[model samples]
Every structure is written in structure tokens, then in C-alpha cells.
Target: MLSGMKVGKNFWNGAEWYLTSWRSADDPSPGPYRRALDTSGLPDNIVWEGDAKTYRAGPWNGRWFSGIPEVLTYTNVMEYEMVISPRETTYSYITKPGGPLTYIVLLDTGVVRRLVWDADARAWQTYFQGPRDVCDTYRKCGAFGLCDAGAASTSFCGCLRGFSPASPAAWDSRDTSGGCRRNVKLDCGGDGATTDGFLLLRAVKLPDAHNVSVDRSTTLEECRARCLANCSCLAYAAADIRDGDVRSGCAMWTDEIVDVRYVDHGQDLYLRLAKSELPPPSSPQAFPTAPVVGGSVAVVVVIVLVLVLIVIRRRRGSTISGKLQPCLSLLSFFFFFSSFQFLRLLITAAYANIHSTLDVPGARSCALSFPCIEHQLSPAHSVTSSSAPAPIVPYVDLLTLREATGYFSESNIIGRGGFGVVYEGRIPDGRKVAVKRIIQSPLLDEGGEAFMREVEVMSKLKHGNLVQLLSYCKDGNERILVYEYMKNKSLDLYIFGEDPKLRDLLNWERRLEIIRGVAKGVAYLHGLNEEVIHRDLKPSNILLDDNWKPKIADFGTAKLFVVDQTNPTLVQTAGYTAPEYITERYLTLKCDVYSFGVMLLEIVSGRKNRNTPTLLSDAWESWNQHRITELLDSAVAQPEPELLFELDRCVQIGLLCVQQSPNDRPTICAVVTMLNNSSSQIRAPKRLVFDAMTEPRLREADHSAKEGASSTSNGSHTIYLS
Candidate 1:
């Protein structure tokens, strides 16, 4: 069918129209394959092979087909429209003016192809084709099965978390058609306090829409609660993702979820599972299994040794004050063991010290004498110094890090932050890396704890826009973190630095891209199973790669909020700190939103908010005065006429983010939608709490408050700005 053509049914006339394939290449008769619109529940395009279904284009989720997230990349070339009413239900698309001419055709093989006219090549070229991959086959992974075409495993199908193959024998032979069954039965018939929770599956296509319930009025949290209350509800997701971070509307599955697969830019699905199947809460203070096991073994060994000693003493006829002698012997044994351990540590330290002083290349002399002394130390010994769990990331040796960064040379330094100095380095394998060395302080233990916290936080997060933590080092008193290096440095360099060449590189388009990238990263953090609030979200913390793509960095101050945990340790930068955080000592995901808004404004204006004491007030004034154009960065050319509306919209969105009350601010999700879709309506932002007074005055008052009280009367933590 050509663009704008429709294949649907007319309810009033009871007439239906659909596309049918030819019998064969040479035959004109209708074939077995037919493409039709299925409106039984959610509307989807289905390719039927006579009596059986072969392929599905997934349901429409406002912006694009749930299974065709790639459509977002080509939105500029065409506009899709869907109509659902009593009269008819139809779907069509119109090519944009001056864009490629496109048409879709159903082949006798049951494959659908979207072809576009290539004027330069003077031939029709394939724009898209489906089933595009093995995963696109209808129910290829069966019910409740997830299909991942890019999975490293030989098999493309696997059961979801908390579930197992229903027919293990069949799956053993490479047949997963039977799908999977829940490992633990869900608690449904309880006193309304059932121990059932959700397992969040991120960036995945929503499941089949059949046997689904949707409510547009309810929020995602409400939907979750409602689904938890229903015995049959199996999964839930946001029906409409266009709303800001506080996503509204609900789509719940009451029956088997089918045709699920991973896709880039896809929506999140919350699959119900028994609480026992859910992952344990992540905590930096959690104890490691190795230490506990080692401790138990050590205790048994000590008890056995004491008993042996007591028997020997009794056999020797040393009966005078027997109990006191045994106690003294036990104490003496502990002292001797501790001294032996101390001596071993001292020897290892001395060898390491000698090794450092030597200039010998590829030396094994020290290793021959001390061979694996530190490595042989048990976890029990390590736990005596610190109870923190072992980090998930690999541990790099201190010597290796030293060689990578030129013995921690001053010439290799890349950047510095509150926690430590970052140095540019290349690993032995030729991979460039950024090494953050946390400077040792008198509070040595606190520094080590913070280092572990950052490592733990970054290890759990895996996203394109967040910097990747590759490894860490905890040799002696040194604590260092190694991350994937970003060549473009940080966003602050381009937007707020003194270099004109650097400032010119970030035009409105790049700034917009960076803004959107940061928003998506923050949204991902906030949407995590255990929501994370990036206590620090300034531009300096945002690093840019060669392509100028932004990656959120400096997660040392990030805080994970578990259930009922609202108060975060007060950590703030002067200008970006949210008013609610400063004045009321309250914190939430909204704090990051507020900081993002300030950064957004800074990107647009090319001026630091801290330097420009009235940046917020000025933006609000300029917006109201209809001179918002004046706020645009003068370092670059003015935005094109077409982009003027977007420029103004961003300014307005930023103002909305920095609203006086946290409740009034839009969620990061909403901010993303607003930034991406210019048509999305945005309410006027409330005036700033310090609209009458400049930032300097506010800072002065904050200083006074800090000196007056250590904490607020309501038991909330006091804010501390650096």
C-alpha cells in the first residue's frame, strides 16, 4: 500500500479491507499470507498465514509501535496516524514534504517490506523489513519468555527472572515453546499484605496487548498498587510514556505475557514476582559471604587449638589454679597469633617498599621471597580492619595503576573534584582510562568507605549516558577508581569555560542534545528498582565523549533511596542546590530535577549561575518581558527562526524545574518528554522563593542559618554546601 493507505474495517457497513499476498511469483491468485489490522484489544498489525499468525508489529504506545522503537530515528521523514472510533479503526502514515517517497508491500513469503524511492540511485530501496530478526517471529520465545537477538548465549530465548522453563526437558533440546513458570508461587490470598513485588525489566518492548487492561487516569504507582491487589495481574507498565517522570496511565497484563523482547529506547515493564524472588536490597554496609565463612572457620580452628592445649596442661599435672591458667593460656595464644599476623603484614609491607624503590624491570626477586604473602591472607584478617562488602568491580593492583598514570605525575592530571584528582592514563592493554585518586586524609577510614560507595554505585548502573566504572584499587591507604575516559572532558568546559574555541563548539543543537542526554540518564537513575538521587548534578560532573555525547559522572555523592528512605545526606553545590533542600533540609528525586533545570538554563545562557547571582530571576524576567532571545548565548549565532520556539520552551521548562516548592517541579521523565516533544503543554512555573533577593543575599542568609543550628527542629538533616 502507498503512504496514507488504510487497511481497516467499517463497523457501520460491516465491511473489511486488508492486504493479501499473491499465490506465487507467477500466479495472480491470492496466497496464504494476509496482513490485517487486529482491533480485538489493542490495535496491532498482524500477518496471518491462512489460519495461523506469523508476525506482529506490536501495539501502538502513543509515539511508536512498541516493537518498532527504531521508528523514532526516522520520525523526521514521515508522520504516522492511527484512528480508533465506532465508525472505523485504521492506521496510515504520510511522508513529510521534501522527504523520500515510501510504500509498504506484503510478499507471498509473508514478510512485509517498506520501500523508499531513491532518486539518486534511480531505483526503489528497502527502508525497513519485518520480521526483521528471529525475535520478531510471533511468540518466538513463547508465553512469559524473553527473546534477545543480541544475547551472547547460543539460544535466543530465555525465561524471565524469577521464572524457569515450564518444560525443562524440551528446553534442554533447544525447544522453548513451552515458555516458563514462576519459581515461587505468588501470594495472592493474604490479609491484603501479600509478599509480592515487581521485577523491573528495562528497555523492553511491551508484551502482547491481548488480555490486558489499561487505565489512562491512574499514575504508574497507582497501577502498581492496583496490580498488586489483583490476584490475576501478572505485569504492569506505563500506558503512556509521554508524561514527565511521574508517568501516568496504566497498562496491566492479567494473562500470559507474550512476544516480549528487548529493544533500544523501549519502555519499562514491571513483572510481578514473589518477594522471595526479588533481589536483596543493595547496601554498602552489607557483609561479604567470604568474610563470614572465613570467620566461622577461624573460630572453629581456635576452639580446637584451645581444647588441645588444655588437655596437654592437665596431662602434665599442672592442676594449681587450672581455670586461671587455661584463661591465661588462651590470652597468650591470641597475643601470639596477632603478633604473627602483624609480623607477616610488616614483612609484606617491607617487601612492597623495597620493590617500589627498585628500578628493575619485570622483577621477580621480591616475589620469590614473599611469594603470595598478601594474597594468602584470609578474608577473616581483612574483615578485622573493615566490614564493608567486597566491591563487584575487579580490583586493579596499585603498582599497575601507578605505571598507567606515570607514577601519579602532576603532568598527567586531567581534572580535580571534591573527592580527589582525576588523571588521564592508559592501561597496559592500550585502553585509555581516567583514574580518580581519593587523597588520603586524617579520616582514612571515611575516605576508603566513600571510595567503596562510589564503586558500588557505579557498578550497579549500566547505561549509555552514565560513565562506566571499570575497576578500582584499595592497596594500603590508597583508594582509586578507574573509569572509561571521555576525551571531550566535561560539559562545563564548553558551556562555562574561558576558551572561546571551546565555547563556540556547543551551539544550540549540541546543547539541546546534551540536555536531553542528561535528562534520560537522570530519569534512568530515578526509575531504578531502588531509586537513586544524584545528590550532585552540575555540568562539571557531566563528561562528554569524542562525539560530544554527555555521560553523567561523579557518582560519589549519589544516594540510593530504599523504601521509606526520603532524607538524603546533605550534599550540594552553591548555585545548583534546590531551595527545598537548603531551606527545609528535605530531599528527593526532585532535587536532581532542580539541579538539572539550573544546568539547562546555564547551557542556554552560556553563563554560570553562581557568577550571575540573578540568573534565575533574570531568566524569569526575560521570559515574561518577551525578550527571552536576549538570554541566548551570544558566543554562538542566534538560533534559526524554526528553533526560536524551542529555545523559549527550554527556558520555560528550566524555570519550571527550579520551582520554589519541590511538589511544583516536574519530574525528570516529564522534563524529557517536554524537551523531546515541543507540542507537550507546560504549565507556568511558580516564582522562585528568593525572587526578590539575589543569590548573594540568599547565600548570606544560609550562612547565618548554618551558624545558628546544626539541624532543623523537625529532625531533618541540615544542608551543607561546598
Candidate 2:
């Protein structure tokens, strides 16, 4: 909505806020790189390389953009506004009064950034930037193609419903730019005779709108009618997606749709397709066929005949009981036959359910419902495994990844761990990311598959406090995972490495924030439909972004399980492992709760739990002695008396998470509630005792190495069985 642009959404539904990069700092001429606020169906931030889109911030939800949850977390300092009226629709950013001066700029290199002035440092700190990871890249999978960060397939893209790639050879080569061609073309005749039906694509960024038309006066139903009336209209959607019942206004696309992607909190988009294009009905043979009908009639007739015979026997009244016996046998046989048919139907339904859960091509493996839609809908989730495909977690090309990392040059190396090495790299679009190349060996084939599956699981995960698995790479003999780069790196460097510069950066308030952030992340994971257990929850696995916001990373060893299900996988680090995990070879969400408690203690004491086994014990004793301040990290500035109470409460909660029995430990949900509500009271924990067997496992911890570590381990590690 800049003054000179003369652009307004009222006149042009496709009007957008464009940002052009200059050739140089002093040059005013536009460069090849540009960014735009796509205000078509829904507003999404997009960056472009010339005319080709390179990145997209998935659509604006009620609170924040669907793709960027971090901004929602830091909303206190900044506010985003989107105003739609009869004359204009505009999107703008506002900084809180007396807050840091911030600028949103599109760099010449095709990277879009949000920067804030830091007066203390006298530098502009990058608050946020994109394309953050491979998933953010626009048209990454091509037109009518779906890109899923959660896909397990080597390639990230897949054709949309009723479509196939236009060029299979190009797709096989991992080049999907040719997009897709319809398997069944629309049956909307020019005379208004149409047999085309709309397919619901849930949780998706609406396709490009250059060829779309808008009519704000119409309701969604009216919009549908209009599209149905016009044979040329390919699709239609509500122009404004708000949170109430009166979601009216219309936007229709008529030409080729491109750059469609699936994301959490995305808008529902309806794609027009012929009936033939739709998947065969779930109950293909629900209606009675001629044979079935005939058989059913025959069974009914036989039952009637048997009843008639029984009546005649009763009328005859000669040994009625004996005559009835024969009729009863016939009735029993008929009932059995009916029961058998019913059981067969039940078995068929079960098979269909399982098939829908896995092989079914849908927007999500599970059911999804939108507020705007009356019923749930499912489209192609992602291309995955042949047997049991989970949702797609897109894979990066090895050559592309190699170019990003400068062919694994030493200078690009940023981290080393049990998983592999992490390198800092920029994709072709100039977006910085972290690339993790899993160490390959003859012994790691199974491990690589496990890692890939775990990445798929993690890619489905989205939270402000959790590190995002944007995309991954699985070339022959190489496995690489691309993630949103954390500028501050792992938490261990600040807490355990005795780096005064790093340690001093975290004050009492910041430390508490980090602790709460991690707790929230763990709670989110635990709250998922299938609860996740972070088997290796330690300081090294916790990362900090530029804003000092903590994000939980490394899910390679994590376990996904349903509530009340029992898993006997003893996957954990030595010091943080719950006692039950080692002794009984049992695992549960409580195991993660215990690890979080240990991490909480470490963050507070600024020491490794292994080195200080008595940290929890000391905390418990100090809480009772009313001298908990003594347990706080001495290196950090002492908390004021008022803050000491909150610190004591946190320590008590930590103790609750690390109690002896699994049942004694608090659920992650309860921990989050406790952290959020300082006034809330917690139950007293049992007397603290460091597990006796924990110390002996320290050698194992050293051997496995930990995630987010900058060092490698010496020996092969044990794989936990789920």
C-alpha cells in the first residue's frame, strides 16, 4: 500500500505489496530479487527471483502467518495488520512505541529479512529472515504439486488429485518444473452442462491468482454458483477467511494454478475436478447388486416359508414342540448366515479404514475439518513409503545440498554430533539454513531409515518453541536434514562450556524464559495425538535463535506413542534417563518429563546433570531449608527476593518431574501449567536420590555423543527397539 504504487485490492483483487531490491546500497534501480504481499485469496508473503517465486510465508491466519509461528511468539514488540474494506485491502507492520526500529527488506540475493536496530550493539540484528528452509521455496514441487515437509519420500513434490506429472522423466530426475497434467479434464461444457465437482484441498496455500477474478458482493454459496455457471471458471474460494459464520466474499481462478503447498493453519481451497478424477468411493459396493439382491430376497423368502411351516405345525397341534424343533434349526441357520454377512461387511469396513489411513492419497493421513466447510475433506497428503506412507516430508537434491554446503568444506562446518555433522549453508535462493549430513556406513542402513522416518514425524510437528525440520535430503549413501538455522546455537555452549561471554548473555529473566520455552515445547509434543518422548532431552539438544528464544531440536531418538500404550525402548542419555528407562527397559512420556526436569536443573545450576548428580537433591533440600537461592547458578546474577520465590517454585516442579517412580513424575502438561502459573501450588515430591546405576552409564553417554554437540563420539551406539 505504498503511496506511489497506485495499487489497491478493491480495484484489483490481485493487488499486492511489492518490494524491489536495489542493485546496490546506493543504487535506486530495481534488481532481479523482489518480494510481495500476495493479497489474492489470502495474504501470504512471497519472495521471488525474477518472475519465479522462491519463497512463500504460507497464508495469514487469525493471529500470524500460517508458516511463521515465531512472529506470534514475539508479538509483544511488533504488531501486524491486514485491513480489507470496500476501497482498499492492505497489510502493514507496526512497532510498539519506544521499541527497536525495524525494517523489512528484500535483499538483492533474493532473501527477505526483518531486521531490528539494537542500540546497545549499534547494529541491526536480524529478527527474522527467509526463505528459511527448503520447504519455504515457492513452486518447489511445481504446479498442481504438493510439497510436504513431513513426507518420507526422497522427492518432496507430488501431483495433485486427478493429475500426474507432465514429464515423468523430469520428475524422476528430481525436476518437477514441468508441473502436472490432468488425468481427467473438466467436463464443464460451454453450454453450462457440467458434471464437474469440486475437490476439497484442506490446509493448503491457495494457488497463484494472476488469472483469477473476484466478486466481493457474493456469499460463498453464490460464489460456487457463479463458478458453476461459467465453464471457464476453474475454482472458487471465499475472498476473506475470517473466524465467524459470515465468511462471505468471492475469488475465482480460471487459468492454470501454480505454487500450491500444504501447511498447518492453511486456508481451505476447493479445486474443480471431473467426477472421474475423484478417488473411487470408500464403499464401492455399498448398493445391492443384482446377485446380492436376489440372494437377499431368497433368504427372506426362505425365512417366510420356515415361519409358515411353524404356523402349520402349531395349527396341527400334534406334537407341536417336536415339529417346532425342525423349524428352529432352520431359523438358526438363517441367523448364522445373516451374522456371517454382517461380519464380512465389518471386516471390509476395517480394511477400508486401514487403507484410508495409509495408502489413501489425502491432504492429511488423519481427518481434517475447516470452519468454513461443512464436512471434513482429504486430498493427497504426500508421496511416501509403499507399505505405510506417512505424510510427505520433502527431500532435497544432493547436488543442490552439496552446492549449498560448498562441497562439505571445512569452513562450512558448524557442528558435530552422534547423528552427523551440521554445516551452515545458503540455498540457491540465498536463504541460510543448517544442513545435517548423517554419517554413512555399512552398519547404518537401518539407522538411516529410522532417522528418515523420525524426520518425517518431526516435520509434521509445528510449534513456536520446537525447531522446524524444513526438509531433508537422502541421496545414495548420504542423508542430510535441512533445518532453520539457529544463530545462537545450542544451549550447552552457554551453560556447560564455561564461556563467560556466552553465560553472561543470559540473565535471570532470560534464563527463566528459556526454561519456560523448553517446557512449552515438550508439552506441545506430549499433547500431540501421538505423544512424543524426547529420549535425549538435554542442554545440547536445546537451541537458541537470534532472539534468545529456545527451540527443542534433534528428534532422531524420539519415540512416538499413544497414551496408555507401553513401550520398552531404553533410549536415553545417562544422566537424564529416567530410572524406569534403564532398570525396567520401559519408556513413556514420563521418561521425557524426567529428562526435562534434569535439563531444568542444569539450566538453573549452569552445570551438567552428570557432573552434578546432587543437583536435584540439593534443590529439594534447599527448598525445604528456605535457602533455594544457594542452589541457583552462582555465576548468574542473584535473583531478587521476590524472584527467588518463583525460582523455588520452578525447582520444586523440576523435582516433581524427576521423582523415583514413573507415576510420581508430572506430565509435561502439568509442568507447563506450573511454569505459566507462578501462584499455582504443586504437590510435595518424594525424597531425592540420584539413581545408583546412573553414574556407570556416563561412559555410554560419552560414546553415543549427544545431538547439537560440536564433538564426535568414539563407538557405535545401541539402537532402542520400539
Candidate 3:
């Protein structure tokens, strides 16, 4: 199609216009592939091959197609328009005046391409193309399956979180048509509050909307409520994302979701799941003992039979009645003696094998040694171990960890802090991992209970924004943790480092996404059954994945604080510590909120808050003086005019979080709500004053007096004062 041409249908006249591909490169005959406009439920461009759908350009979502996020890059070269009315519907595009010529074409292979004339090159350059990758194939992953072209697995299809393959055999055979099924069935029949919750899947193309319910008048929260009220609703998403923080309009899906895949700059889809399946399951119960007991019994019986055979052979010649009684007595005596000795040997072997398998010292009890049965009975290994359950957290051997990290070479170190040092390593399975070796200190003690506590806490907590704890090691005096490696490292490198190029990469939209992600993570921590307070929340603790998604890290200083519990502890970083935590030694959920507030302002300004009055005072003054724009990082390009309001709102929220009194600051949950809902009113923040020199000097003196006190060169240091 040319730049100024239109292709669509006129309902009143019963006339239509579309494009068809040639039968061959040299032949002009119409082929099986055709490109046409589809207005069934939403306006979109679809490609068909012999009446079978092949590809779908996602529905028009205000600025661009929902699936084709690349359209934003081409806004300067051309403009697209889609019109829908009772009389007619059409789609067209026009190149900018005095710009190079541009046009689109459909190939016989069912691929679509847009070309632009290049004056210097003397040829047409391909500006964009569709059916771009494997993920673009129609229903590539089947129903409820998410397709990721960049996944490390050989197959590009995987079931969504909280779901399992409907047909495991089919999935193993590289067939994903069976899709997935919920791990825990939803409970929609509750009398009061429903037990169903939604899992948010971010940066994904919305599923096929042919059977969806679209209401442009309702807000996202209203959409969520409506979906929760109706049992048939399966998922929901925002119909539009044009506004900065106020995403209006609702799109609800009642049928099985299909054709969902990851895309750049995509929207979020919340899938309804049972509450029971939301949290990670507790560590698996101790290994079953039935297998061990049964194996030992079988061995004892075998020994008894062998002893009887030996006794019979030795007394074979004594057939007389007088000798028969003596032979029988000898057999009985041998059977009992052999059984006892064999049982002792079995237990000894079991103990040794268990220690080797688990890499734990002093595991002398036979009850926890079931894993050794397979090694003892090599012939019946498969039969003896088929029913055994896997351990939730596997124990890594010191030798394996040493090899992974090149014997703790200095070059392999990724980060170092008060707790320990983190090294980047690749395990035997060819998966990249971050290995943290705990520093030997008196605080952990010889029992290593502190290490276990950290592992237990991390194992139970599961969220997309939280760094996942893969496995751990506790051998002798060594304590280590393994985590999924993040390619982009931490937020501090980009926002507060010396590289201007990296700082500029974080545009306003990306920064907003990071802020929202961190907020959700903190809210999750506070909303847990036993609330958690991250005494140290800073830019250095927020790690970014390959996609730049933020994941909260460094849980060494985190603590589980139940409601009304006053477990006062002094463990915090310099700048991110709350006022009450520092002066009164009081730790609460609000303390984390305060730390988050400080980090939020630091993120916007791209500056560290290590100095007492620099960041907080500057932010407060900027808000009151109506110079919020001046607070933005100079490295970042100015945001669009439409985003200025959101930039100002972020500064106001930051101020509210840093109020002198903990009660005055909003809860982390409330902070998340404020960030998402632009309509929510924000109250003015209370004034906070810092005795600049007094606080810094006091902190330094306190550190010198305390034993085992160490700090990093950067002000982001952790202080552990008991």
C-alpha cells in the first residue's frame, strides 16, 4: 500500500479493499497470503494463508498497536490512522510532509514489511517487519502458555507461574497444545471474602481479545473488582496506557487466554489464581523413612537365609535324629548373630552416605539418612528410590562451589558488603548464578543458626520483584547462598555511578517502572503474614535483570517483625536508615517505608543521600518552592510535557515518606496505591530537619566504639550494632 492510500470496508456499500501477495516473485497472480483489516472485536491487522489465520498485529491501543511496540520509533517518519464507525471502517497512513517516501507490502510467505526511500543509499530501506520471530506465530504456545523467544530452554513455550502443564507427556514431546492447568483450584464460593488472588504478568502482549469484554469507561481498579466479582472472568488488563499514572479503560477476558507472549514495552495482565498457590510452599518435609526401614528388613531376611544355608551344608552328613536337634540350634544361633551385625553395618553405611549427600556435619541419626538407600542397594536403585520426594532446598558441596567460583578468585567478585562477598559463577548445569560466601564473624556463632534463619525466610518468600534463593551450603564453618544472576547488576551503578552514558539510559518512563517495581516488592514484604522490615533499602540493594526489571536484593539485614513485637535491633545503612531507627533504636515496618522514601528521591535525582541534609533537604525545598523539575537528574533528557505532572507527583510522594514521625508517613501498601492511582489525593509532607554535622559525627564515633564494625568506600555501608 502507498503512503496516502486507504484499505478497508464500507459496511453500508458492502464494498471492501485489501492486499494480496503474488503467486511468485515474477508472477502477479493472487496467492494464498492476504493482509486485511479485522474489526470483529477490536480493530487490528491480520494476515491469512488460505483462509487460515497466521499472524495478527495487535489491536489499536491509542498510540500504537498493542503487540507492535516498535511503532513508537517510527512516529517521526509517518503517522497512522484507524477509523471505525457505523457506516464504514478503514485504516490508512501518511508520510510526514517533505519526508522520504514510505510504503508497505505483503509477501507470499505471509510476512509484512514497511520500506522507506533512502536518498543517499539510492534504494528502499526496510524500516519495520512483522511475523518477526517465533513468538509472533499465532497461538504459538497454545492456551495459557507464555512464549519467550529469548528463553534459555530449547523450547520457547512454558506454562505461566502458578500453573502446570495439562499434559506433561505432550509437553515433553515438544507439543504444547494442551497448555496448562491451575495448580490449586480457585475458591469462588466463599461467603465473605473470596480466596482468589491475581498474579501480575508484566511486559506481555495481551491475549486474543476476540472473546474479551472491553469497557472504555471504567478504570483499572474497577476492572479488577468486576473481574473478581464474576466467577467466569479469567484475566484482566488495562485497555489503554496513554496516561502517565492513571491507566483508564478496562479489558477483561472470560475465555481461555491464548496468543500471549513477551514483548517490549508491553502491558500487564493479571491472571486469577487461588490464594493457596500464591506463596511458595514451605520447605519440604523430612525425607520419608519407610524406604530405609523396608530396605533394611529385606537385607536382614537375605542374611538369615544365607546363614541357614551354611548351617545345613555343614551338618548335611548328620542325618541321625540325635544330630538334627544340634544342627537346628546352630542355625538359630547364627541367624540371630548375623542379623544384628548386618543391621549395625547398614546403619553405619547410611550415616556416612547421608553426610556425604547433604554435606552437613554430625548427622549421626538414621532417621534422616533415607537418601543413602539407593547407594546401598545398587541393583534395586530405581525401584527403591522411585517413590522418594525431592528436597525443597538442595545442599551444595563446598568443592562444587569452589570450582564454580574459581577458588574464590578476586577477579570473580561482583560485590562485597558487611555480610559477605558475592561472586559470579556458572554451575555444572550451565546456569549462571551469584554465589555469596558469608564472612566468618562472631555474630553468626559456631552453630550457624543465623545462616539457617536467612535461608528459611528467603525460601518462604516468593515474588517476581524479589531475588530468588536457589540453594545454599552449610558445611563446617562455611555458609554460602546461591541466587539467580542478574545481568545489569544494581540500580546504583546507573543512577549514582561515574558513567554518564549509563545514567542517561534510564529515561523517565523506565525510572517510573523501577519505582513501581520496588514499591510492589516492599509492599509484599509488609503485607506478609509475619511482616518483614528491610532495615537497609538503598539503590545498591536493588538489582536489575537483563530486561532492566528491578529485583530487591541483600536480605542479610532483613528481619521478620510480627505485629506488636518490639524487637529493637540496630542494623541499618548510613543514609537509608529511618530517624526513629537511629535515635530510639525502634524497628518497625514503617522504618522500611522511610528507607524506601529516601531511595525514591535518590532515584529521581540520580544522586546519593549519604550526606545528611543534601538529598532530603533539597527535595523538600524543591517541592515547597515549586521547582520540582530542578530536582530531576541533569544526565537524563527532559521528559515529554505530558509526563511533567507525574515527575512532580513522585517528588511529593518522596517527601511524604520522609516525615519525622513514623505514624505520619504512609504505609508501603498505601505508597504503592498512590503511585499507581493518579486520582488518589496526596497530603502535604511534614517538615524534617537534620543536625547535619551532629548526626554524621555521632555515627562515626559509634562505629569506632563498636567491635567488628566495617564500612564500604561508598556511603552505602551496613552497620551491625548489638
Best by lDDT: 1
Q: Which model is ahead, 2 or 3, in terms of lDDT?
A: 3
Which tens-of-lDDT digit does each residue in 464-512 have in candidate 2?
8878787887766777789999999999988887777778788776777
Q: lDDT score, residue 195, model 1?
A: 83
lDDT of 3: 0.71
Candidate 2 has which clashing residue pairs, if any? 149-393, 150-392, 150-393, 151-392, 151-393, 362-379, 362-380, 362-381, 363-379
What would the per-residue lDDT of candidate 1 be over residues 143-220, giving only the tens digit for each residue?
Answer: 889876533223668888788899999988978888998899999985566888877675567888865787767888
Q: Where is model 3 more than 4 Å wrong at Cα?
A: 1-391, 556-567, 691-694, 697-722
Model 1 residue 445 CA deviation in Å:
3.6
Local accuracy of candidate 3 as per-residue lDDT tens digits, 85-173: 77666778777778788889997767787767768545565555567556677877788888764332246688876788999999999
Sequence-dependent TM-score of model 3: 0.45
TM-scores for all candidates: the values are 0.45, 0.43, 0.45
Give the Cα error of residue 548 in candidate 3, in Å.
Answer: 0.6
Model 1 alpha-carbon drift over 4 Å, by segment: 1-391, 441-450, 557-571, 691-693, 702-722
